[model samples]
Target: MAKNTGKAYEEFVRTIQQSLITAEGMSHLKNIEVETNKKLTDRNGIERQFDVYWEFDLGGYVYKTVIECKDYASSITVEKIDAFIGKTADIPGLRLIYATKTGYQSGASIKAEQHKIDLLIVREADEREWTAEDGTPLIKTIQLNIVALTSPRITSFAPNVDTDWLEKQKDLNADIINHAFTSSLNNEIFISNESTGHKFSLFDLSHLLLKKIPDIQYGKGTFSEELDNSYLETKAGDIKIKIKGYKLDYEYHAPITTSSVIDYSKDLLGIVEKYNTGTKQMIFKDGKIK
Candidate 1:
């Protein structure tokens, strides 16, 4: 798994390099090399190869841009960034760029600015600015819809936030699920759109929905036949969807892993009865509104 992952990472890094140097011709950069295998000895005598390198003419001065791409489950810390910067100090006129899948942690931007280095942080999908329910403006990183049992495909757009690791994970999960699903189903997919709305076989929807909402439970019997007679049941935190023409249209809502504000309000009385008079068992915080 690690080998395959490394191969994919190398490929992705190369693709980006090609896009910048060959396709985009970014500035005065030339001869972008991906994993040229030019090994350097770290300050601790540990050897590491540069992930990418290119020559750029900055104000008629030829400078080398050395990049280190990191894909890790955790965010890059100041120590790691410092190490990468230290790794290139031996080479003269070295401009450093660090690209990470998980992004850098706090103080990274300050360190980069202090060192006059370019830091590129990439994540799965960029964030978008949106107003909250209370009209508070904020930005949220877009979460990709990764079907657990389907192959993931990424549609790229200019990211509002870094999402390198998220994107990688989504793509990897998608690839595995898609291959299995395609193989299991023999790749025979059909689509239909009628005036009554789109219609798909219960078998297909069942599989798709199962991947999408694995926690949801469907009642006994097939869904294709139950669509026409069912009405949705949304009480008890259960979503009972009844499709008029297909029995398979009855997909129970996914389990509630998290509760909403309304859920607490609706069940407040029950909670109060269950825990309010508990003889100091339920301790409220200083600022809490009991």
Candidate 2:
């Protein structure tokens, strides 16, 4: 497939863009107009322009989406992403999209795992041709859209009492065990011993810890358990685990891949390092670090 130069990709993106325009009109877009070098003022009162911006009208509301086209069949940089988001942040109801001739970056999938933001790669594939029994070309246009779109929602962490309490230990990095532990012992409790005290205010801790775990369960094996928010992210590593609450009143566990192929160990450490010392030791083995 790589030898073919990814013709399948180019076809997909072209089709997707066309479909988006034809099916969904932009603000003031009577007909699908692909505009390049489109400029818009930013919140800082600075004028900024995009490589490609789509404007259409939808349901009496004008809508605009910003798109950046890339050639390298890889992912984008965080720095580049920060700039893009910054540009459109002020545009009310504005959607951001990316177009690339190559595939996505390794990090792109991670960012896109939820509401599928932060990654958009366009790879072209070879056009398929079909012939009749007589070997004559079939009269057909196969314009398919293969791009995926995610909702525009922020992924929150699952509630962890220990993580929440350890987050308060402060001034040092802490490692949060990916497991879910909920006890009716107390709505707000502190589980740490003297010299290192950890406080878990059910409300504050739940909300805070939930930002990292993304999924959690509260209750016993026999009773109705309360689940928390959902996280839309790709597993980057195995060392990190996530639990989240979902709509159907269920608690789900998301295990970060432990396989060596994934590089999430560092990322998880970075995330957990912002917490307490007591929790930090639990994550690091023999001070050699994972």
Candidate 3:
């Protein structure tokens, strides 16, 4: 017999709630509320508990969205969608969302479409490494895909405003590079121009260069001085970078790939060299870093 776990479905609900809360457009909404297993009274004086509830203020109006999570081995049936629709009718201006781990039946999809309910199929990413028949090791990684069966029809009630985060996607590559550099070095890197000096992290330099020259492509490889040499190249110019290991006190030795070469590289070498004391050594002990 299979073991009975009371909280077996709690993690699934939490992951869905978190994904919605952190989504590109959803996070910036004001007065956002996300809850799970919330009990409330309906219009007909009937009490009901929701699996997940989300509400937010947009354009001076509060919008409510309720989610029902089903973690079953079989697909959700039309009967379940009909029951959900009946409950949604009691709550005014409530958007009903149904999420299932095993997807929905064909009739269930039709029912959701008729009621304008949003259906989401949530699946966790599967990652594994195995040897093939030829003795070659292979790896596979699959990401979670939150597919919407029907689009929410409640947008007409609120103004169609584009999120600032979505607008930044055009410059996403540059933004990612900047964020990585600045965050990695804690905003200590600096760059000087013809007249003025500006400070940026490794990511900042990359972003700035990319912006100045649109054709440049940023690439990275495994840290190796002899075999692998990583560099940033553009139509204007190219710079060679070395992957040097810097040993911090009692910490893991971080690889500093870029040195002071141009306007961005000044003072970076000194800062990185300060941590390269070579006193702290990493010894492989029992297949672990020590």
Question: How do all models score by TM-score?
Answer: 0.36, 0.34, 0.42
Model 2 stretches astray by more than 4 angstroms: 1-16, 23-29, 112-119, 127-290
Give one digit per residue, the lDDT tens place, for model 2 in 1-290: 35644344434444445544443434234776666667888767888877666666757997776666555544465555555666666756767776554444445534434323434443322212234457787543433444442211212223332345345644324332322223222232222222333333333333443444454444211112233332211122222222232211223334333322322232221111111121211121112222
lDDT of 3 by residue, 236-268 (tens): 222112222111111112233433322221211
- Which candidate has the highest TM-score of all? 3
lDDT of each: 0.45, 0.41, 0.48
Better of 1 and 2 by lDDT: 1
Displacement of the residue 2 alpha carbon in candidate 2, Å: 23
lDDT by residue (tens digit), candidate 1, 1-290? 34434445544554455444543445435444545345766566777577766665657887666667676777778888788767776665677777665556767766776787766643232221134457786543333443333321211111111134335443345455345334432123222333455544324454555565445553422222223333322222122223233222343433334322322222111101111122211111221222
Count clashing residue pairs in model 3.
Answer: 3
Query: Which window of 10 residues has the lowest lDDT sum in candidate 1?
Result: 267-276
Which is the better candidate, 2 or 3, if ranked by lDDT? 3
Which residue pairs clash in candidate 3?
178-203, 181-203, 260-265
**Cα distance off (Å), candidate 1, residue 27:** 8.7
